[model samples]
Target: MRKLTDFEKQVIEQKGTERPYSGEYYQHDVKGVYCCKKCDAPLYRSESKFNAHCGWPAFDDEISGAVKRNIDADGRRVEIVCAECEGHLGHVFEGEFLTPKNVRHCVNSVSMVFKSALEVVAPVKKTELATFGGGCFWCTEAIFSTLEGVNSVVSGYAGGSATDANYRAVCSGMTSHAEVVHIEFDPDVISYESLLAVFWQSHDPTTLNRQGNDSGPQYRSVVFIHSDKQAESVNAMINTLTKACVWQDPIVTEVAAFDGFYPAEDYHNDYFELNGEQPYCKIVVKPKVDKVKALFAELLKSN
Candidate 1:
């Protein structure tokens, strides 16, 4: 609400370029929120973050759509700005930080604020993303978000062509979109493989283009891999399962890198979670939840 306190002042502005804690991007280190110091727009989460010698908060990634970047005033520099209010944040550099992407976003801490947590997670701040398609994003997103490590699961249409689509178009089986859930999770506690494993088990992958009675190309069994390694990993898992005779029939799941993911209409998100008491919720989602609990007993919370 107000300017940062004195200790905050030192961390944000007092550090020199070469000192140990001087250029330290992550001080609290475990888990915290990184927000715009100017407008308080929530920016980075601590999970995808790593320590960099960069003279500002160096993160491997940002909370999607919270902040944005454009070529800076220097024209050569890519300017990072608060997507909420266009407040100047900092610049992005490459070949400097080391991580999966080898990218660094050098954001001035003066441009950011931090939040402390009484809970393990400060719900007020996060930068999280996870995607899944469980036949009708409504059903898919509803099931996943109930589990731990899942922060936000948005229903969407992914791996599609250019243009807008709605329930009519998607249901028509012409949009080339798979119903998906963009999930955000705490990676430290759960690995991507675990999420993928949950995804594979959650829905009936044996069905060619449907879940339960739902049928159509829109309901097809597909896993959109976001990275090359993800493609290899998922493919390997499928191959291993095939070799082990997991499914009597070959897995017809489509494995491909994502070109794009388009979110479904607002009404679709949390359909099962909200409508759990409704007919579809009781008849459809509840039974599915039971199956997941039985199949994934190892993954279930002990409590």
Candidate 2:
């Protein structure tokens, strides 16, 4: 029963922060049961663990004496308290397994030290967040809502003829508002260039003051780049599109230095999901969704 070194403890804590089940901690495959580091209460038998890739060690079930279950402070039903001395462990949930027991004991890897024989790598996270605006925040917003790796999509206005612009004046095409969406994405799963490709295909950037059918300066196409790399990637794609004559009229999409982005009112967020039956959604948004699903099904999350 040797004490863990400082680095080992740090490793555990660091792995805990990355993601619940996304680290190398769970790559272990040996014949030893995992137990509480604090009190050595057997939390899981090695045979029960499976390759979940959630960054945490996952098991089909835990040894009965090794843990306790209780209601958490959030009022959500949870499991915790190691049996030996009642050390606080994380919660347990049901229905994750596709197999028989139909449950997963999603334990924090760091909380209990693994006693496996083989070496295991820590899991890593490879997701990124980005904000973008094209034109007609409504149109751009609606278009990106359908892509893959897109955890969530939100519409808002950015870069303007005026600060603190609203949907009305921007719709008037006077406040110089172009539609936009903030996208949460996983970089390991999708690339920004692919998203750019979707952006170009989803809207008519060739139109200077509009995005086909939605005529107005507010609806103009633009790429509000978040960083130098994003700017370079966007510019490279624009160059390729220009050389290839992807747009008959000429690429009007501007790669402007992104100053700032403002989140739109709550109601404006996820307009397509919220107002699926609305007339604009049916006519404008639905077609975009259909096109994305047909052309970019590989990038979408499973329903």
Candidate 3:
């Protein structure tokens, strides 16, 4: 079980009441799921939440079998607790007519944690990994992070001879490391070919060892294929693009077998997002992000 603070223990274990309007989620209105703070078991959906004007978070219903009810110590009011861990979750009342359900679950915000719907992807038995280098890692990371099936994007160094690489070493153009974004995605939702299509459109793959004035081997356009299937797919894509005359210049993108990747520094992880106002991000990364959004609106995660 997760450890709880004194205040959380008071409300969740001791059945203590928090002051009205003092909870963090009293006025929260994000579309997502709320889970038990103690056990992480989903207890409510955001759609069931309604404005009760009672200075506490109110939900019209709870996830089936997630919340259990019992008579209060006074034998008058009904108390609700997490069915999994029996943690206190406040009370349930009916006949208020606040909504069609005519029920209100006056829950303590401290008892639950909200997970944004955009962050929750459907469960899959297996997930796939794809890595690519498209000039700046920041640009590729920002673009892929917006895709629905993409589970994660980590900025790193690959295609290098160095046993270990860092931003300073790679930027020096001596490490042979191309800045890359390692992506984990669900192939069932977004195909590898779809990712390649986005990649080809997001950056200039025809320019040799350069992307928008960033000239170095570190910024070279490349793809690291993890399997033979990926190799075949990428080769087919390259042939199709070549026949279609996608670019006036020949594509310089290097197709290489998967190699070890060394993650960049911590601050480099979400560069475009955390440093959007910075001139580099605004000038170099923002345009790629905007291009992906415009060209692949249907593949983006729902807000």
Ranking by TM-score: 3, 2, 1
* TM-score for predicted model 2 compared with the true structure: 0.59
Error of 3 at 273 (Å): 0.8
Model 1 vs. true fold: TM: 0.56
Worst 10 residues of 3 by lDDT: 294-303
lDDT of 2 by residue, 135-244 (tens): 55665676776666777777777777446467776777777666677787888777887788788778777878766677776677777777899988988888898999
Best candidate, lDDT-wise?
A: 3
- Per-residue error for 210 in candidate 1, Å, reads 2.0
- Between prediction 2 and prediction 3, the one with superior lDDT is 3
lDDT of 1 by residue, 1-303 (tens): 447556544533342123334433445575677877656768888776676764457777889998777885557978777788666666777876388788887776566767644433544544345566768676677667766677778777887774745677888887788777777787665667777777787787778888888888888878777677677778888888889888777788887677777777887777886677898888887877777656556765542
Locate the minimum summed-lDDT window of 10 residues in model 1: 11-20
- At residue 72, candidate 1 shows an lDDT of 57
For 270-292, candidate 3 gives per-residue lDDT tens digits of: 88889999999888788879988
What lDDT does candidate 3 reach at residue 228?
99
Candidate 3 residue runs with Cα over 4 Å from true position: 1-124, 162-164, 298-303
